[model samples]
Target chain A: MSKDYNNFDYLSVSVKSDQLSRILQCYRVLGWTEVKTEDDKRYYDMSYVRLRRPHKIPNKDRLQYLQVRMESAINSLVEIVGRAHVKSTAVISVLVIIFLVCTGLAAWQFLSLNQAYSQVYGWICAVVACASALAACIAGACLRRRERRAAADKISARLKLMQSLIAEAKLLVPQPQNEEEERAGEVNNG
Target chain B: MDKSSRASHSLEDRSRRRRQRFTEDKLVKIRTEHSAGSFKTIFAALIILFQLGIIILLGTLPAFALWWYLLILAAISIITAFSVLSSHRAAQAKAVWVLFVLVFFFGGFIIYFMSNDKYMYARARRRHRAIFARSEKFLPEYAALNAAPDMKLTCSYLSRAGKFAAYNNTKLQYFPSGAQLFDDVIEKLKSARSFVFIEYYAVSDGVLLNRIWDILKQKAEEGVDVRLIYDDVGSRAFSRGMRKKMRDSGVQVKVFNRLISWFTFAMNYRDHRKIIVIDGCIAYTGGSNIADEYVNEKHMHGYWKDTGIRLEGEAVDAMTLFFLRQWEFITKKSFDYSPYFGHYQTLYSPYVVAPYVGGPEYELTICKSVFESVINSARQKLYIMTPYFIPDDSVVQSLINKALAGVDVRIILPSVPDKYYVYLVTRDNAEKLIKYGVKIYYLRDSFVHSKLVLTESCAVVGTVNFDMRSFYQQFENGILTDDKNVVAAVAADFERTFPDCDHPASAAKNGLARAVAIALLRFISPLM
Candidate 1:
């Protein structure tokens, strides 16, 4: 049945769990009013948010494009957040191998070499092994921290871009002057 | 013969015995259910007890003499007769009640009081009315009333009396087979975004329900609002474990008229509607229920032929309302229904679709009226298909009248009946109509579960069968559309079915004893 376009068009968007508030904020500027929010039952890390906008809004294509970009930005932001928790396996592996090699050399000097060389060379190798192990711990922690920082920086940039897109989108779709206008504008605009 | 040949003959005898044993077991089960009896018998027994109490109380009272007691009984009978006369029951039904009252006196009067009391389903009816009233604002007014000029009067009647509006820009798709409808239903459910509302009479445990449950579970997990309502008696095979599984997955479940929970005869009024509304955009309704037999995965009769129709766009709003009305009544909670109604731009279409509902709450039998309207409007042809053919006298008369007026009237019923007693009555009714020049056909080896009525002007496809239960006793929904495409599709289905159906001549068996049995069964068919 055809109705006077006074009705609102609705959309449902799913995003990572903690990101709902920010997504709603951005969507609000894009003329979407948050209707309800639900946590995904299967995916604990995801949540669904339903939003409605005036039907037949001006520049719908541009607004939809911005919405897609905003969603993509949120997706990338979630991936970056996940990436921050990722450990640098390559760095950890290299450090572990170095630590093991030094320990092996120290064992060889202490157990198989002659007494004179064993005392001197064994002490040097033992010190080197301990230092390597300490270095492995320090290097692994530093690598993880650096990766997290880089991920945070990328996320911040993406958030800024998303915010700018929302602003552009907001300008494309005019805000309603009043409640009555908002309700009636959907039909009149088209 | 050799010894091997003798052994083969013995093996054949054993197989034959096993087959006979299986058939005997099935008959025994049916007999057990029949012996348990129907609601009418139980209610009648209760009414007799009430009458006995009144009689004994009057007889034992010291202040009242035997003459006084007799006088009181006479007064009560007179009052009850007046009440029956003033009531809105059909003329024929009222006549039957009057006959019973004169024959059985106080017991019959008490039976009428108990059955006609609005107190039976008062709460449910009140809530349903409220829900429907509240939904009226959310529904946009019918804008294309003149789209189908030929059926304007019927549409107007439904809009005024049934509270259903004619909708345009709503697309209709007809499915000739249950399997195909289900395949499409599964696919459509996969695309659901906001919500899925399901209401059905029966949801037997089978591959069909399992597949639907899988989709519903996944959809619920994805945060879609998935709500299901099934009649407890109809879906008895839907195990508690399955219900818990659905709940655990966040699919909201509600059982209509739980037989054990409700200590009343209201349980007899089952929700016999088959509705599946997906996000207020697409909906499906017809004779098919959520069961294996509907899809022919498992057969109780032989081949099960069920039909369904899919609605896309605005007509779906009415279906959504139908589900919510029942849901609200069962749950006793109101909801903000605005979010579920879709906003769509008006697309131009030639056909007009009006989806309507009927139940005990409405005084008028809406389903019967629609059937009559279609029958009355048919000048050239009228075709009908149903699993059961126990229509009330008015509907039978309408068919017979049309057939006599030179309209080519035909009805197709199931040959392999799920219930033998009901089938006998159906066959007997068919025989009566055949004598009036109405052609009746039985689909051989198959149970046609489709509730369809097609004529030259319009068509009806929904859960409303040509039976008293669907017409008066149960809550039902149907689509009354003048869509040429839909009507043509239904006509085409009937055309294809005719060849497969056996005429009443070969399907009927005449005998005095069987005739007496059928007469007895037909008399109580309305109570059934």
Candidate 2:
């Protein structure tokens, strides 16, 4: 049999300080609170981040409640990422449209310059316009690529965090439910 | 088509031979024990199994009363305890007394083992996540260094080899013998500015160590943070006064593990790693320990051959971390690691040096994984040098596979036995492995105390012995480098040493008594 679900009241994990900060952001958004922070002398690179669930949770149904919290939080993350993904896609599409518009204007300018022996100042203006537009197009493409990568990384990290939380829940949750324990939780809830 | 048919025929022959030999080996049980306790042994095993079955049944029962379950458990536990203790009555008096001692006897060991594993596992999982995502936002340089997407390192992220981060432009200077190694160590000690971390398995009070002691004392007096860690069993002759003397001179001293008695597995796991990091940037590690014999000044074995490496660059950060971890383990106090950082200056050298450290604190032996990779990747040449050659089954099969795939497999062992019983076990492996196309050579010039593994691509040199102890029990560390010069140096050493060795006659010529003795010895090779 697995360990009694009641044994796990909190979680302590080792991570870099920066990572702990990001993880803390997620937990606080989920209504969880930081209960402790520890840095063992030996592991300077890794610091222990301890978190506690807000509000008092009784022994029974702790696993069930925690599981609910994790599922809800995971859904929230998925929604957040979905919105962010859509936002990024829209931004990239806008950039691409701008790029195409700028490229067309530059092509038109180049064609006119090719057809007519124009004033030196007009010719300089056309060349500068083409150069700046090309620059913007390249910058937009690079930014789009980078933003996509960042979005993917954020989603992956959050999913991994949720997976770990669910594993902890599984360890705490007993396969067979206790009727007495369920009644006790109901009483506490009432 | 003809070549493919020949290959098929060879494969069939190898499979047939393997089956035949394994069948014979399984059936041939050496009957060394008397027939008196056979029935008792069988009954005891059965009792243990039956108890396990009962516990599982009770544990999985459908919503049973907790009180009744407790009662049943107590009754059965008492009954089984009495039965088991009855058999061990010759070693104990009262069954209750036996039970009390039993609860606490292995408690310390069990707790240490479990907590250490959990702690390491937690750390490994974090690193694994970082690796899985290839996200440098969390650990940028560390992740990049260890992330070998191009290298065929099919090692688990939990293992040392897998978790290792390779550093570039690290200077790797090879020391072919102990003479150069010791001399260069003192030179680096002379240049020590901030800290000196030294750990060795065998640190005898001899000519070499005394000279090292004088240098260490001078450095300590000069205000260097000199810390020394030595194994309790390997350096048993290390006097309390010597330790006190080092302490008095401002040199910090820590012993690896204390022995409860002369005959006990209490201190079975040892700190066999030989590491010396001066100022955190310059480090040295290899098979040669601190003793006169290692330097060949004392004639225990004539011209004792060993190897060491002088590494300089970012890779020393890994070595320094290894030392600091050991220091923390022994001292039970965390040392400030900030002072050791930013001191290393990475130069422009083309070497990928990765430090691989493993011990009994972890079950996944990184050194063994490394050896398997080296053997599996070898296409042209595979050379090995060790005093002992008692390999486990996986290593044996890997070697066989490589040899059949046309890889030149050569291993050098000591003709002069520093350990006779261990030599017997090594002989056991040699006798078996040689039949499958692996060449075994005896180093007749002297005892080779070096631990080396070299392939066509890379080489591993450090303190890992080719036995179960080094792979599974003791703490070991080595450098896996694809540096061309370093691999060439190791190969050249093997080339020079091959002339001094002679291939033994085939194991088919061994007598029945010798064969039986080898089998019995290999059975308990782990304890040895």
Q: What is every candidate's C-alpha DockQ against the true complex, given to 2 decimals? A: 0.00, 0.00
RMSD of 1: 29.2
Worst 10 residues of 2 chain B by lDDT: B25-34
Which residues of candidate 2, in runs, are more than 4 Å off? A1-190, B1-162, B262-266
What's the lDDT for residue B190 in model 1? 93
Runs of candidate 1 with Cα error greater than 4 angstroms are: A1-190, B1-71, B117-119, B144-148, B261-263, B343-347, B505-509
| lDDT of residue B358 for candidate 1 | 93
Query: Model 2: which docking level applies?
Result: incorrect
Q: Tens-digit lDDT track for model 2 on A1-190?
A: 1222122224444444445576555444333445567652334444556554422233222232333334334445545555554644665566566656655665666666654544444556556656655655676677667767876777687678667665655455432256586455435433
Q: Which docking class does model 1 fall in? A: incorrect
What TM-score does model 1 achieve against the real structure? 0.65
Candidate 1 docks with a DockQ of 0.00
Residue B377 lDDT, candidate 1, scale 0-100 = 85
Candidate 1 local Cα displacement, residue B297, angstroms: 1.4
What shift in Å separates residue B400 of candidate 1 from its native position after superposition? 1.8
Q: List the residue pairs that clash in candidate 2.
A: none
